[model samples]
Target chain A: MRIGVVHETAAGERRVALIPQEVDGLRKAGHEVLVETGAGVAAGFPDAAYAERGAVIASATDVLGAEVVLFVRAPGSDPTLADALLAWLRPGQVTVGLADPLGAPAAAAALATAGITSFALDLLPRITRAQAMDVLSSQATLAGYKAALLAASRLNKIFPMLTTAAGTLPPARALVIGAGVAGLQAIATCKRLGAVVSAYDVRPAAREQAESVGATFVDLGLDAADAETTGGYAAALGEDFYRRQREALGKVVAASDIVITTAQVQGVRAPILVTAEMVHAMAPGSVVVDLAAAQGGNCELSEPDTEVDVDGVTLLAPTNLPATVPAHASRLYAKNLTNFLKLLIVDGAVRLDLDDPIIADTLVTHDGEVVAPRVRERLGLA
Target chain B: MRIGVVHETAAGERRVALIPQEVDGLRKAGHEVLVETGAGVAAGFPDAAYAERGAVIASATDVLGAEVVLFVRAPGSDPTLADALLAWLRPGQVTVGLADPLGAPAAAAALATAGITSFALDLLPRITRAQAMDVLSSQATLAGYKAALLAASRLNKIFPMLTTAAGTLPPARALVIGAGVAGLQAIATCKRLGAVVSAYDVRPAAREQAESVGATFVDLGLDAADAETTGGYAAALGEDFYRRQREALGKVVAASDIVITTAQVQGVRAPILVTAEMVHAMAPGSVVVDLAAAQGGNCELSEPDTEVDVDGVTLLAPTNLPATVPAHASRLYAKNLTNFLKLLIVDGAVRLDLDDPIIADTLVTHDGEVVAPRVRERLGLA
Candidate 1:
């Protein structure tokens, strides 16, 4: 089996699917690795670094012709890359990436027409056995950790209070909305930075996880019945419910020195939890990190990928926080991808075992069709 | 006595001399407080905010006309504002600020020619009774704390090591050069954020202070006899000593993930601790924060007041870090200024007692003469 890694072409995307450190693992598993020239440069890995680790430095065309190709981000959501990616790939080839098929299933359609087998890594089910291969969790961890740091950097006051000879400084208060992977990581990182942390989530059980990570859980006095879906994500509660939730969260937002909103609804437009009034009420030096900026933002005033000064408050709507720490992001992503790729390597060849739930769920397209049930159903194909 | 505060006109200076919370104390002491319109706006205190605290909002001209005027930054050292400051202020009016006269004695000369009583807060003596009035220590505390946060935020990896489901991440290593107030604070802050911190200083007594606040002191195995001056600052050891110090420190710097330089020699240029070659030897994605940037950066490649990428390392030369966090910086500065201002108020009037060492040391000019001995000596007026 031959594995290929290429340079990412998306704006603000610095992570590569594979790093040179993990190339030895692929070779040990009886696979040849081909890395395009300067593929990992932006992620802090040079061509010489990859070549030193037994990875062949090749041109983009040669690497694309390999049996298996990998990417951290794919053209599934970017319509501009659809034609270019399709033209570069061929039949019987395998592509593995967080293709973002949920947002743009049309990308899967293009892959199907090209008669190639494509696995959308984002579709990997949340299961114990599949934990190692979970690209979403790995990337979300980086995003959440960076989100807390981003808030701390933008804040005017220190996160941790200290009693000095001059006077005592009170620790900054941080409030995290959403108790998912990103939210929990944010809570942990903020705690590590010595902030007085409080987190909120509609799912009642999320309180345990938040509390376990040294964050006080804020429970709004509202019945959030069946707030969590079977997929272990927050269920959409409609506009009326969100409006009332925002109203209830106004006081919390105003009291907090830093607010981090990770209220992403997976494939849907992110819910606006922090309203304009809420943001305006925050202190002049308060900071807000909206992790859902790329998904239309969890705050009303957030402009995706830009930092705005609302009065004196700083609102950072960074679209790709993982890119900001490309070194660690690439490292974790490479490990997750290597874990997934290891599963498909059966006796020095690619194995498409549809019986396994991980394989069946992540396989977005195969044999000239949108074979994944979810993508097929999304495309209205029987 | 009437005290007035106007907006600071210095580049990137946002801190104010007084805050609204401390204005009530001045009023209770039988003094009138005047704040120029928008004086505290950048410091997170609006005109309405000051007005609510019993401060009268006045024009810049009226504020300067008051019996006593306060500033976080003065026209001192800035020739552009010398003539304007001299013209705006009339004789007999008292001006107090961090005049920066130690570094630029010529600035004190301009104030003396105008026949105004000027007090340079930076010249305040390091006595027990004057601890509350030490603006340099107060402002440096903020600068050091912010320096650590800036380094963490710019870093490519998290400061803390965590055993996550993905894998364990190692904590980042931080090195602090010069164990002054700013350096010790940086060490404490980096340690609080979970970075493994090490520090170095030429003064032997500085080791105890650095170690007391969670830092491993680095000794270069060189004879550092007579390293401390009478004023408790590092003695100017000349180029030969600095060359040997940099040579010994090269290995230590290359091993650290983040390096913070606070090696300022008061009233003189900062000694370069990390050279371009040393920076080049460090791992990619490392960060260096030069806190002594305004004094001519401790890193050879550092550009004061800007962020630069040297090879692959991020060198942040932030000037006036206290100004960047104007809200708390103003609060702390106000507390220190108010403490000193209380000493000058007697029988509802400003008292200038030459007997008080605190007053005598800080008073740069009085009665049409450069009165402070240090300023006079530096200006060749002795």
Candidate 2:
């Protein structure tokens, strides 16, 4: 099979679908790989590197001629590129990457009209065997890690403690609102930086995890045992429960020098943890990193992807922490892509076996039809 | 000291510092509690409830004249009310609530200079003794739970599986990137909703937690032995480790239909987990709940507090998921505040011994100065 890697045309994106090293892996797997000129340059993987790795460097036009066209962000992300790709696409050729399919089902239909097989990675099923292929988890780890770094850098005080010639500097206190991956990482990172960390979670089991992370668990004694749904996610609490919980947390919010909140229930708006009142309670020069700011903010004063000085506290809602460290983020994403390729490509041929749980589950559009039931429902296709 | 509860003046904020029922505990502890008219109306508690609970309803001016002022948020949050309170504040009075001390340290200092002692709920320490008083953790629990609900609500597919009259709906696959409070809630909620859940964390110890919540642990095969620091938080992994981690996770992301990424490193940017390429690899109509959207987003296409469709995947970054259910959120916050109040108000008198670890650690400012060392350092006050 021949795979072509195109330079992403998405705005603010510098990552390539296939870096030179990944190309080598493809060659080792007995597949031919082609790279558009300068696809990997921005990410520090030059076109020459691809050639050295047994990849053929080609123009975008030549690259798209292959059996499979890969990209970090597909043409759907860039309408101008989408038009060009639709015109250039050959029958039976496969297109893969983030294609914005739901937002532009018309584009998916267009691909179908052109007789092209397109795979939208965003629809991958969550399963054990597919763990290695999960790009979301891989990238999330980076985002979680980066959020802590951004907070620490912008924080007024050092995260860790120091006992130099001066008086002993007590460890900075850090409060992580959510005990999710990012919150956990924040706790871990803060602890590493010698900050005293505490965390909270709605699920009963999170208490133990918080304690294990050396963070004292803050339990708001709400009858939340029933708050957990069978699928292991938190069921939305009643208004009564939330009122009680917030009252219990008020003190903690006021005491911490740095509060890193990563609280969100699935599919809902990000909860406003740091109310304007809470912000007022914090000392001057306190910093709050609201990971949920985009959703509306854990802090009431938080503005998405922006930093605001509320009273004396600095509330930062960074929108793209992962992009700040593109090199590592891209590398991780590329590896996820490689692993995914390994699953669908067997013996150098792309196989779409509906019987395979992994394949059947992740397949949304197949043979020019939206086959996934959920997707069909969302698109009102049924 | 007679404690008085004031209604919040911030627009759209309905939580009261103390619910009428909560005042019973304070009264039982031998403290006289006063409630401002309509303080608990939005939280479903009426002034009549306070009268029933042996509490006196008073005007805002009357409440501010009490020896101690209690509120959901501090004066900075409701400048108009705070100004009124300041006018009536006598020297040596005490004020407690979410003060936003760091954001509004000057305000706190102003109160202190006026001979009023202030305690910021945001400053509560993460310690065992202070756990009950930890307002941040309690509210975070709600935020985490709320995030999962938001994701599930907006998701195209049902969270759990069902053997229907037509056929068996395979269990929805949910991947929670972070294992913090919100991530755990998402996992628990997803599991309860009948989805197969898998979770990832940088800290090796989080595996036990993930499993406890019925989530399969997704290990990326990295040497994470050093991932945790002494304080039990995640240590920042070197770039090399992050590279390998991303590679391992890419495969997992490619298989999940619902990827709720809660990976946030404190004070930094949210890591980008779902790249445009990764999203493309997913099946169409997938949903990505980027809880870290405010910090930049775990998904490449996520816009802060908005929903973006990438290749048929819905990237929802709700900034204020909790606010969506403000009634409940407010209730939880009230409870947290009540618990914190119990810690400081002993026998109708405000205590500021500073000998207690919880109190000492949480004190951000005192006597018109930023007494907290961390706050001092943040302000460059040596």
Candidate 3:
């Protein structure tokens, strides 16, 4: 199998699909890997670094037309370059990456029209066997870590308490809202920074998960029956439930020096958990990081890619935080993609087991048809 | 004694001379406190908060004309507003704060001409009795903690190593120069964040200080027989000695993922430790934070309040980092000033004992005469 890697062209996107370590593993498995010139430069892996790991340096034109094309983002996701990317593929060639299939299912139809077999990593099943190939979870860890770091930098006081020759300073109070992969990571990181951490979640099971990460579980005393969906994501509660949740959370928000909100329902607008009244009640010099800003922030005052000062409190709504820590983000993402590649491609030939749940779930388009049921139904082509 | 506090007029200065917590103690000591409106607003304390603590809120003019005026910055530091501030005070009145008298001795002469008693906190002696009144050490601790946080935020990797489902990530390598109050705090902070830290200094005594803060002391193999001055600060070395030091430090600087430089000879130009060629040798996405940027940085490529990128290595030269964390900076600074005031004031009357070493060392001007010998000699008025 000849695998291909190219430079990511999205604005503000700094991660590369395959790093030198991943390339070295593929070469040891008797596969030839082709890397585009300067593909890994921004992520601290230069062309010479890849060559040292047994990868052949080639042009984008040559790499994109290989048997198996790998990418951090789907080339067809960008409409301006969709046609050019589709034109480079032919029948029986495989494209593997996150193509925003849920939001833009039409891209799957385009890939099918070009006779390309596409496996969208975003659709990987949450099974035990697929844990190593979960790009979303791997990237969420980096996003969570970066979010806590960003809040600490913008905060007006130190995170940890200290007793010195001058006096003693109290540790900062940090509140984490949610218990998903990203939220758990945030709780862990804030705890490591020596902050007094507390967390809240709708699902009762999340209490243990948050507590395991050194966070005190915050009980709002409101019954959240069916707050979780069957797909391992938070479900959208109606307006009445959310109003009560916000009202109960006001006092907790006011007492904290840092608040990190990470609640989101997939393919739906994120719920507004932190109201303006709650923000106004918080003390001056406090910081709020809304990790759900890209999906319409959990805080009402948050704006995507903007830092707003709401009456002296800082509201940071940074979009695509993983890109800021590109070096480690790419390393973790490449490992997930590499694991997926090893599972699908065996001994120089592609193995598409139609009956396998992992294959059936992640395969969005195969052999001139929109294959994945969820994406196909979303495109109205069922 | 009627002690008054006013807002700092220097640009980007956010700290207040006294906080409400410290004001309560002063009021209990038989001192009438007068505070300018919104004096502590930037430090997260409102006028109403001070009033609740028995502070009499007044206009800037009323506060400036009181028996004694306290400030975080020198009223004479700003040339544009110096004359206006000096005109507001009468003879026999006292002013206390950091007045930069050593650098601008002419300001001392102007204050003396007005028959005002001036005491600069920067001249405080390094004695056991003055340890609790050391504002410089208190503020440098904040600067060091902030420098580590800034470096962690700017770097394109995690500070801690993690073994996750994706793979393992190694911890970041951090190097600190000058194991003083700031450098020791930086070393402690980086260590707390789980980074591999090493520190270097000219004085041999700094090895234990660095080791106590969990940093490996780096031996650069350079001679520094007289690195310590009588004031307990790193003195300026000869040009040949510095050249030799820089040559030996090049390899360590290039290998570090984060470099924090805090070396500065007081009242003189800071020595350049990391040259531009050393910066070029660092890997991409590495970060260098110059904490001495205000006095001309320890790095050759640093510029105050600027972020320079040389060959993908980021150099952050931030001036007055304590100002960035103003809430805690003021809180700690106010405690130091409060301790100094307790030592100087007796029976609520202005007591001037010229023979006391504490007063003799810190007093810059008294009764229409430049008093401190260092400033008098610098101004050619001895």
TM-score of chain A considered alone, across all candidate predictions: 0.97, 0.84, 0.95
Expressed as tens digits, the lDDT of each residue in A39-80 for candidate 1 is 887777889999999999998898888899988886684445
Which consecutive 10 residues in model 3 chain B have the weakest lDDT in total? B73-82
Q: Write candidate 2's Cα lDDT for A1-382 as tens digits.
A: 8899988775556667776667777888988898889787665566787899899999988889998888666654445566677888887788777665655566666676677877766555556666666554554544555565555544444454533211233566788888766677667656654578888877778788777767888877766777565545455667677667778888998888788888765435666667788888886557888887645677778887777987557788875454544444566567667777887889888898878876675555556676666446656786
RMSD, one per candidate, in order: 1.6, 17.1, 2.2
**lDDT for each candidate structure:** 0.87, 0.68, 0.87
Please list the residue runs of candidate 3 whose C-alpha ends up more than 4 Å from where it truly belongs after superposition.
A75-84, A87-92, A229-231, B75-81
Top-TM-score structure, candidate number: 1
Per-residue lDDT value at B10 in model 3: 78
Measured against the true structure, the TM-scores of the candidates, in listed sequence, are: 0.97, 0.48, 0.95
| Winning candidate number (DockQ) | 3
Better model by lDDT, 1 or 3? 3
Sorted into a CAPRI-style docking class, model 3 comes out as medium
Residue B196 displacement in candidate 3 (angstroms)? 0.8
Candidate with maximal lDDT: 3
Instruction: Please report how far candidate 3 places residue A89 from its true position, in Å.
Output: 4.2
Accuracy of chain B in candidate 3 (TM-score): 0.97
Ranking by lDDT: 3, 1, 2
Q: Which stretches of candidate 2 lie over 4 Å from their true place?
A: A74-91, A98-116, A223-247, A264-269, A293-300, B1-382
